[model samples]
Target chain A: MAAISLRRARTIIRKTLEKGQEMGLKPLSVIVLDEGGHVIAFERSDGASPGRFAIAQGKAYGAVMLGMAGTAQMQRAEAQAYFIAAAGAALGGQMVPVPGGILVRDAKGRVLGAVGVTGDTSDNDAAAGRAGIEALGLVAEV
Target chain B: MAAISLRRARTIIRKTLEKGQEMGLKPLSVIVLDEGGHVIAFERSDGASPGRFAIAQGKAYGAVMLGMAGTAQMQRAEAQAYFIAAAGAALGGQMVPVPGGILVRDAKGRVLGAVGVTGDTSDNDAAAGRAGIEALGLVAEV
Candidate 1:
C-alpha cells in the first residue's frame, strides 16, 4: 500500500481549501491522516471555529479506523446508534459519524489514508475532500 | 508565540481561589493552561469533588483549543450541538462547553493562556476566572 507523504498531505489541505473557496463555502478546516489514524497535516482557515480541528480529525480518523467512508459511518450511526456511540467511546472519541471523511486509495484499491473537512455543510465538505484527493491523482473512496 | 509562565499560572490559580473564597462561593477547583493547552498549574480547594480536576481542565482546554472564552463555547455548543459533540470526542473528552473557561491575553490582544474554574456555579466560576486574570494584571478575554 502507498503512504501519504507530508508534501502530499500539505497539498491535499491546500487543494481542499482552494475548492472550498472556489465554491464560496464557509471557511474550512481540513486534516489528512495516515492509514494508522495519525495526522499528517491539518489546517483551519481564518474565522473557522476551533472545534474544526477535532471535528475534521475525528471524521478522517473514523474513516481510517473503520475502513469505510464517513457516509457509510453516517448510515451505520443511524442504523446502530447505540453501537456507533459505544464505538466512539471505545475509540476515545475519535469516531465522528459524518459525511466529510473520505478514504484515500491507491490505483490498486489499497487504502492510503483519509482526508476530512469541516466548517461548511457536510455535503460540501465531502465534495471538497474528494476534490483534494483527485487533485493529487489519487482515488477518493467516498 | 507568547507563552504563559509558571509564576503567572500559579498566580492565576491562587487569585482564582481567593476570589472564590471572597465571593463566598463553594469549594472551587482551578486550573491554568499554557497557550499550547498544557497544564501549568492546578489547585483544588478542600471539599471539592475529585471530578473537579477534569471539569476544570476541560474548560480551560476547550478555551485554549478554540481561541475563545468558555462563555463563547457555551453559546456555540447551544447553536451547534452535533459539531460540538464530535469535536469533544476528537479531543478525547477534554472539552467541556461551559462558562468557567477564560482566555488570558496580552495588552496587544494576543492569547497567552487560559484559566478554568469549577465547583461553584458556572456564573461564579467565570467571575472567579476573570478576577484571577485581572489580579495578575493581565487581560481576561471572557
Candidate 2:
C-alpha cells in the first residue's frame, strides 16, 4: 500500500476548488484524507455558507472510514434514523454519508484517500467533488 | 481584500497535521474559515473523536463573526451560553467560539481568515493551528 503524500492531497483540493469555480457551481467545500481517514486538507470557497467545511470533511472521512463512497453508504444505511444517528455519533458527527464523495485511487487502483464536497445541491455537490478528484489528473471511477 | 484561497488553506491543514503527528499529539480536528466566517476546509484525523469539528468550526466562525479572536469572543459570550448555543444552532452547528482559533493574515497585516484545531487541550489546538499558519508563510496573529 503506497502512502498518499500530503502534498498530493493538498494539490487535489487546490485544483478542484479552482475548477469548481470555473464550472459556475455554488462555492463548495472539499475535504481530502489519507487512506487512514485522517484529514489532509479542507477548503471552502468565499461566499460559501459557514461551517460547510465540516460537511465536506465528514463526508470524506466517512467514505474513507467505510471504504466506500458516501453516496453508496447512505443507501446501505437507508432511512434508519437510529442507525444514521449512531453512525454520525460513531464518527462524532463527521460521518456524513451523503452524495458528494469519491474515493481516490493510485495507478494500481489501490484505495487512497477520499474527497468530499458540500454546499450545492446533491448532484452539483457530487459534480464538484468528482471534478476536484478528476482535476488532480486522477480517476475516481465514480 | 484578498480572500483565503482554498489552495493556501489546504496547505496549512496538511502541514499542521504532519507537524502534530511528529509531536505525538492526539489526532486533531482542524478547521479553516474565510474572513467572512465561511469554511474553507477542515479535517478530523482518524482516532480523533467525533464532535471536534463542530467545536472547532464554531470557534473559528465565532472569532471572525465577532470581529475578534476565539478567546476574546468566548470572554464576551461566556456569560450567555444560551445565546452562543442559539447562534451555533442557527448556523447549523458551525458557530464555535472556543479558544483555538487565530486570525489568519498576510504579511501586510491584512486579515484573510481564521484557523482552528481541536482534539487536544484548547491551548494545544491553538498551538497546532498557529504552527500550520506559520508554515504557510503567513502569520496567525492573535
Candidate 3:
C-alpha cells in the first residue's frame, strides 16, 4: 500500500499521451490519483478543452473510489446523475465522470493508483490512458 | 518566464476559497491563469457544481483576453460572438461568457494573474472572485 509517486504519474502521462499522438487524437489532459484517489498531478496539453482537466481528474478519482474502470462508472453515472452527484458530495466533490482513465494494480492485484486522460472521445481517452499504464509494464485492473 | 506552476495555482485556489469563506459566499470553484491566460490551478470547493470550475476558469481567462472583467466581456461578447469565439478558439475553449472573475495586478499595475470564482450567482461569483484577488493585495487594472 505504498503511496503513488509523482514519477509514476509523470510516466503514465507521457506514455499515454505518446499513444494518443500515434492515434492522431487531439491534445489531452492527464490526472493521476493516489491509492486514496487524491490528485497527485495534473497536466493539460496545449489546445485541450477547458473541460479536459476536470474530466480527467474526475475519471481518475472515480476509478479509484469505485474500485473499477472509469468506463463502468461512466455507464452507471450517466444513468444515475443523482447517484454520482451524491458520490461527489460525499467525496468532497472529487468525483467526476467523463472518461479516459483506469486503475493500476500490481501482480498481486493491489491497487496502485489511477490515471485519467481526456481531450478526445471518451473511449479513445480511456484506451490511451490504459496504453500509457501498460507501456510501463503495469496492469490496469479497472 | 516560467509558466505558473501547480503550486502557485494551489495557492490561488486556497486563498480564494478562504476569501469566499470570509465573504459568507457559498463554496466556490476558483481559477488562476498565467499571462497567456492558461489555467494554472483549479479547485472546486465542496458543493460547487462541476460546471463551476469551467465557468470560473473561463471568467479568468476571458478577463485577461478582453482586458476587462468577465462581466464586461459577456456584454461585449453578446454583441460580437466572433470576437469572443475567435479568441476562445485560439485558446482552445478556455474562455467562457460567464462573469465573476478579474485580472490581478501588482501595486505598480503589472498584470500578475487572473482569478475567477463561481458557486453562487454569476454576479456574486464575480464579487467573491474580486474579493479573493483583493485580499491578495492585488488590484484590477481594468
Candidate 4:
C-alpha cells in the first residue's frame, strides 16, 4: 500500500498555495490526508478564515473515506440529499460534500492520499489542489 | 499570532461570573479561547447545567473561527441558513450561532481572543462576556 510522506505533503501544500496566489484567488487553507483519511499536513494562509481548517479536513476526509473525489460527493449530495446528510452524520460531521477534494494516486493507480483546499471558489480550489499533486508527479484523481 | 494569556483568561472568567452574579442571572458557564480558537480557560458556576460547557465553548469557538462576534454569526445564520449549516457541519458541531460569544481585541483592534458565557438570556450572557473583557481593559468586539 502506498503512503504520502510528510515531505511530499509539505510540498503539496506549498504548491497549492502558490497556485492560488498565481491565480489571484483568496488565501487558501490546504490539508493533505493519508490514504486512511488521517491528516499528514495542514496549513492556513494568512488572512484565511479559521473555518478553512475544518472545511479542508472534512473535504479530504470525505474523498478518502468515500474513495472518490469531492466532485462526485457533491453530485451525490444533490441527487441524494437525505443519504448525504445521513452520511455526514455517520461520519461524525467529518465529511464535507463539496469540491476541492482530490484523491492522489501513485503510478499504478494506487491511492496514496488526498488534498483538500478551501478559501476560494470550489473550482479554483480544486484546480489549485490538482496543480499541487501534478507538480509532484503524482496523479490527481479529480 | 496574538494570543490570550492564561492570566488574562482567568481574569475574564472571574469577571464574567461576577457580572452574572451581580445581575442575578442564573449560574453561568464561561469559556475563553485564544486566537487559534483553542480554549484558554473555562469555568462553570455551581448549579449551571452540564450542557452549558458545550454551549459556551461552541459560542466562543464560533466567534474566534469566524473572526466576529456571535451576534454577526447569528445574523448570518438567519440570512444564509445553508451556508451556516454547512459551516456548522464543517466545524464538527463546535460552532453555535448565538449572541453570547464576544471577540476580545487589543487596543489596536487586533483580535486577541474570544469569550463565551451561557446560562441566562442570550443578551445577558453577552453582557456578562463584555463586562469580563472590559474589566481586563480589553476591547470586547461584541
Candidate 2 lDDT by residue in tens digits, B1-142: 4777766876888787887887778888787788777766777776666466667777787677666776765766678778877776776766667668678888998888888888777777777788899987897854
Candidate 4, residues B1-142, lDDT tens digits: the string is 3578898899999999999999999999999988888988899999988898899988988888867588988887686454455667888688888899899989988878789889999999999999999998899976
For each model, chain A TM-score? 0.97, 0.84, 0.86, 0.97
Q: To one decimal place, how large is model 3's interface RMSD in Å? A: 6.8
**Superposed Cα deviation of residue B98, candidate 1 (Å):** 1.3
Best by DockQ: 4
lDDT of 3 at B45: 62
lDDT of 2 by residue, A1-142 (tens): 3655545666677676666777877877777777777666666676677767667777787787778787787776786657766877887777887788778887778888888877777667777667667765677733
Worst 10 residues of 4 chain A by lDDT: A77-86
Instruction: State the weakest 10-residue window (summed lDDT) of model 1 chain B.
Output: B79-88
Tens-place lDDT digits, model 4, residues A78-132: 6777787777777888776678889999999989889999888778999999999
**lDDT accuracy of residue A129 in candidate 2:** 69
Among incorrect, acceptable, medium and high, the docking class of model 4 is acceptable
Selected candidate, larger TM-score, 3 vs 4: 4
Candidate 2 DockQ score? 0.33
User: Interface RMSD computed for candidate 2 is what?
Assistant: 4.4
Residue A35 lDDT in candidate 2 = 78
For each candidate in turn, the TM-score is 0.75, 0.60, 0.53, 0.72
The lDDT of each candidate is 0.86, 0.74, 0.72, 0.86
Which pairs clash inside model 2?
A: A42-B41, A42-B42, A43-B40, A43-B41, A44-B40, A92-B50, B58-B95, B58-B96, B59-B96, B59-B97
In candidate 1, the residue pairs with backbone N, CA or C atoms under 3 Å apart (3 or more residues apart, or in different chains) clash, namely none
* lDDT at B42, model 1: 93
The residue ranges of model 1 lying beyond 4 angstroms of the native Cα positions read A1-10, A17-29, A34-55, A67-81, A105-112, A118-128, A137-142, B79-82
Best by TM-score: 1
- Give the better candidate number (2 or 4) by lDDT: 4
